[model samples]
Target: MTGCKVVAIGGSAGSIPVVAELLQALPANFQFTVIIILHRLKNVSSSMDTILAGKRSGIMIAEPDDKEVIEGNRVYLAPQNYHLLIEADKTISLDYSEPVHYSRPSIDVTFESVAQAYADKAVAVLLSGANPDGADGLLAIVSQGGMAIVQDPATAEYPAMPQAAIDRNRDVVILTPETIASFLHTLND
Candidate 1:
């Protein structure tokens, strides 16, 4: 429960089911805080937090305020039109920086920030997505001595995001959704 203090997960086009499954598989006492960034429309209001929270996974899921404290056993989603950042104090901050990779709440931005904030205590996962947004960030996480995981491209609805991360960071652990869930289950051990 103490090895990894934070988990950052990002995805796009085809990640919802995987995310749901992963969350469902986690126990109520799961040890780390989770931060998620999924590419979304700049103008639309996102119901992602509500939708995910309703899953009854025993984890609280919500969009965080600009300077909210990061807590364990909860999931925080990046708000639409804002990029979520991990402050040095281990709190969250939302930024309106111009979209990276043509998407707000870019995986790259969140991953990079957490890589620096939590360093080796961080774990990053790049799931199914249509673009290459998370590859560089995953690499950054690894460069900072954090763990990186990617969905196997063959199992992804959109292979680009996972594949990009694989291409950039060869050391990434790649697995199917079910297997990924099982792997995450071991994090606290």
Candidate 2:
């Protein structure tokens, strides 16, 4: 309760396997509320929680509700048709607003929210994604003094998102999924 506030992760398509490997690489007590931003259809309901819950334990996982407190030791997933924003008070706010970069639950929005809230204590991560959606947001995290990490383009199944972030911001940490997950384990320890 007295450390970094959040870990915001973005991914899509081939990200499932990568995320699984990252989760497996991490130790059980890896703290912070892990927020996952995925490309989801607005009209279709998704059970990402149920899908990922099959993998591991020691952390609760669910779709985030508007104004819900982001607790440590939980995974808050962005629901379909909503942009998940982290408020200044460390709670989540769901907005059914228009899409940014054609994404309903934009990764950019989530990263910006975390950047504004926790700054240097926040960690914004970009994984395998097709478009350039998370590029600006990753830059925002660095601008706000938060840690910015992206999956290595060579390792990422879809490299555009990570490549875009790197092209936009040179200082970002572009690493493999395993390395990023390991880095999280060392934070605040």
Candidate 3:
């Protein structure tokens, strides 16, 4: 889809490596704002943003402070223990509400919010995870006329997440990690 403004990616369990691979493949000048929501442990400190930043192929990466304005050529990660939300004004909001699917920073919350915020100008990607957290969220994006991409179950470290999304929306584009990056690059062009 042309005029895409934001790409929301959600995952858990074995998704980190897949996320790294995808980020590494994106060109330095990629123009869409990227938001990532990964299930993480509560009360535990993680340097995930630093780790992902290390793999950056020119895109900036960081965990956004609440109310930060969304920007392109950057990747924003949802902090652990907070639900990440996209505001209609193109800013990020952090919520400490009850967890969804037994996890805070629920993929469903972020994806659904992005669907509402960006609508047809959004892209949602569902990746590897041990649970079914992201399936409904991917469907939400599709319902809003946004593009949905699900990692191929065969290539996932834990297939439940991607499989769940596929089960929910069979029409979503299914691709391996490498191909997902290639497809995203086309969107930039």
Comparison by lDDT, 2 against 3, better one: 3
| RMSD in order of candidates | 1.3, 1.9, 1.1
lDDT of each: 0.88, 0.82, 0.90
Q: TM-score for all predictions?
A: 0.96, 0.93, 0.96
The segments of candidate 3 whose C-alpha lies over 4 angstroms from its true place after superposition are: none
Residue 151 accuracy (lDDT) in model 3 = 93
lDDT assessment of candidate 2: 0.82
Clashing pairs in 2: none
lDDT of 1 by residue, 45-83 (tens): 669898988776567899999999998888898898899
- Give the Cα error of residue 67 in candidate 2, in Å: 0.9
Off by over 4 Å in 2: 1-3
Under the 3 Å rule for N, CA and C atoms, how many clashes does model 2 have? 0
lDDT (Cα, tens digit) per residue for candidate 2, span 156-187: 88898888899999878889887887887775
Q: Which digits, one per residue and each the tens of the lDDT, describe model 3 over residues 43-96?
A: 888999989988764567889999999988889999989999999999999999
What ranking emerges by TM-score with the best candidate at the front? 3, 1, 2
- If both were scored by lDDT, which would come out higher, candidate 1 or candidate 2? 1
